[model samples]
Target: MSTNATTAQSPFDPDKSRIGRVLCFAAHPDDIDFGAAGTVAAWTAAGVEVSYCIMTDGDAGGFDPEQRDEIVRLRSEEQRRAAALVGVTDIHYLHERDGYLEPTHEVIRQVVRLIRQLRPDVVLAMHPERNWNRIQKSHPDHLAVGEAVTRAVYPALENPFAYPELAAAGLEAYKLPWLWLFAGPEERENHFVDVTAQVDRKLAAIHIHVSQHPDVEAMERTVRGLMGQTAERAGLPAGRSAEAFHVVTVNGPGTIAGF
Candidate 1:
């Protein structure tokens, strides 16, 4: 089934994408690297403007408790290199503590500011909804960033009255036409992006996160297997890879699943 701006269930096909600009909002430094780096590479290769907004510094992301500060510096540098690998240069870090994220008013306001400033045609974020069987998909930081970005996409962006300071600062309300939630609840994968040609680039980006994934061979197999599963689900041809997503309808009847 083909997809367009009008429908939510169809895949977020980069070929048919009307979106000129995109902002990928993520929890940790390497979240998008693992999940959507191929899609980002493809979108950039197609000349679509893409920016990354990583909410946390990822200080708590690694196994080594001894190299805390060094890990932060290493992860930040790694993320920049990884982003460049996929042709994404505009990377912003929000410096929030990795494990202590909560979707507070301040977090919402900060994300709202970023959303207004970037003004992407579509916002890509993690789905706050959890997958009980896959606990890794439901990381607290991911949920916090997702919820904060979701809030920014809705009433915060739709209602200028909600954030009066933003209006006073000349950053008025802005509506996001599309919200694509990556790594959603297991059954919520209604959208996908074919990454057949860019899967290698995705692997390379994930490789840059050496602090978290020192075992490259095992990581490769794990990631490739996951992407292959997604491709299978999307009905793509054998050897193809895909990134999955859940499309959330904004200002519609609650979540797309709510109705």
Candidate 2:
């Protein structure tokens, strides 16, 4: 839908919020684009700093083992290119084994350390509270990464006592109260962004993941079609492209003050 039509009362203002640093944690390489690249694009266009923390190297994402390492390398490059398209400069690959992630203490500690180092104003991640029945448990890694990131956002990053090494490394305690979790089955989303203005940029970013470009393109078309349907359903302007998000307040006092 056109951004003007979707404009409603909400606290999220891409123009006002100075997103000094943004940390986006995704299950795989391309998950960020699928979930919230449009918003990321908008944020970066407004000069907000953006960074990506990919949970896996995607070594097992493809069908061939003979060229798996090469494939992973190329995928990482693609992710970097995609980040650039969205005006993001830094991309961190955790180098964890793909498709084999587990919510171990080691993993939690690593995520907590990254959060502490980045000191981001906003964090985006896969929805841990997604409807379990509908979720594809086939990818246990996705679930594991999501759960770990969720846990690390709070006490792990905010609690000074949780990880002593972080403080030792000169990383002070910081809290990211604003979090956006996508793909949840029952999230309370009161905001919608008219990405019509930024749809091409979003598509260009998605196209960077060459391994998933075909699938990503198909999904983008589907999303556009769905936006059209949503417009028609609402008796608003049809054929308008858009993106949706579920804003979750994770820490202290939340407010829709500027909406």
Candidate 3:
């Protein structure tokens, strides 16, 4: 039940939470790949079903707006390919206008419907806290999506009375109490799934975002470099290339349900 960030190198283990269905919510096409692809690969390899829910179409993500529609389409295709690489079959795009995502009731309801229908065991989302001082900090879209997803994960999905029409569709009330919020203010993560065996697969999956290949490739190098630095800072072993996460257990005494 504690809220803290932890590195991927930690020996901490999660409980046997059946992770048969996982839904990763990201603001844009590349967010999930950059933030948690390695872990996604690990989960998929273990037979966990993984899906991506991108909040935005990423129209404002590219360098050119003249080709906004085309860019969005291309980005979506890239995301699909990337999902395939990671063994995910379903990819849902909200197509919300890029760069201006607000946590509206409508958006929350939509996410809630997906949660109910998918019945995901694990939901991965960005940290919603704002960092005004850090000008180059997290994107506003990311923050908004995080907030909406968190709210929806609780009341929206569990309360059958919340969205009546969804219940009519046979999407019954469900609760996904296990959540992993990345890039939180704190840096002590609670659960760390070993991605050492799937690091290369992660890199390959990341490479599928051709529109961002250059920048992502550069970022990959930086991440690899930072791994050593992070280990030094945390006083852990060196040469560790890991992705960090802040886990939030909404239920079950902080236990992961599936293996």
Model-by-model lDDT, in order? 0.82, 0.71, 0.73
lDDT tens per residue, model 3, 51-141:
8999999888766556566998888988888888878879998889989998899899999988887887788987787645332337889
The best-first sequence of candidates by TM-score reads 1, 3, 2
Give a tens-digit lDDT track for model 2, residues 100-189: 888788888989888888888888877665556447522577667768888887667877887888888888887776776665553344
- For all predictions, the C-alpha RMSD in Å is 3.6, 4.5, 4.8
Better of 1 and 2 by lDDT: 1
Residue-level lDDT tens digits of model 1 in 28-48: 999999878988888788778
Better of 1 and 2 by TM-score: 1
Cα deviation at 16, candidate 3, in Å, is: 3.5
Off by over 4 Å in 2: 1-18, 63-66, 131-139, 213-220, 226-236, 252-259
Report how far off residue 66 is in candidate 1 (Å): 3.8
Candidate 1 — worst ten consecutive residues by lDDT sum?
Answer: 1-10
lDDT winner between candidates 1 and 3: 1
Task: Give TM per candidate.
Answer: 0.91, 0.82, 0.84
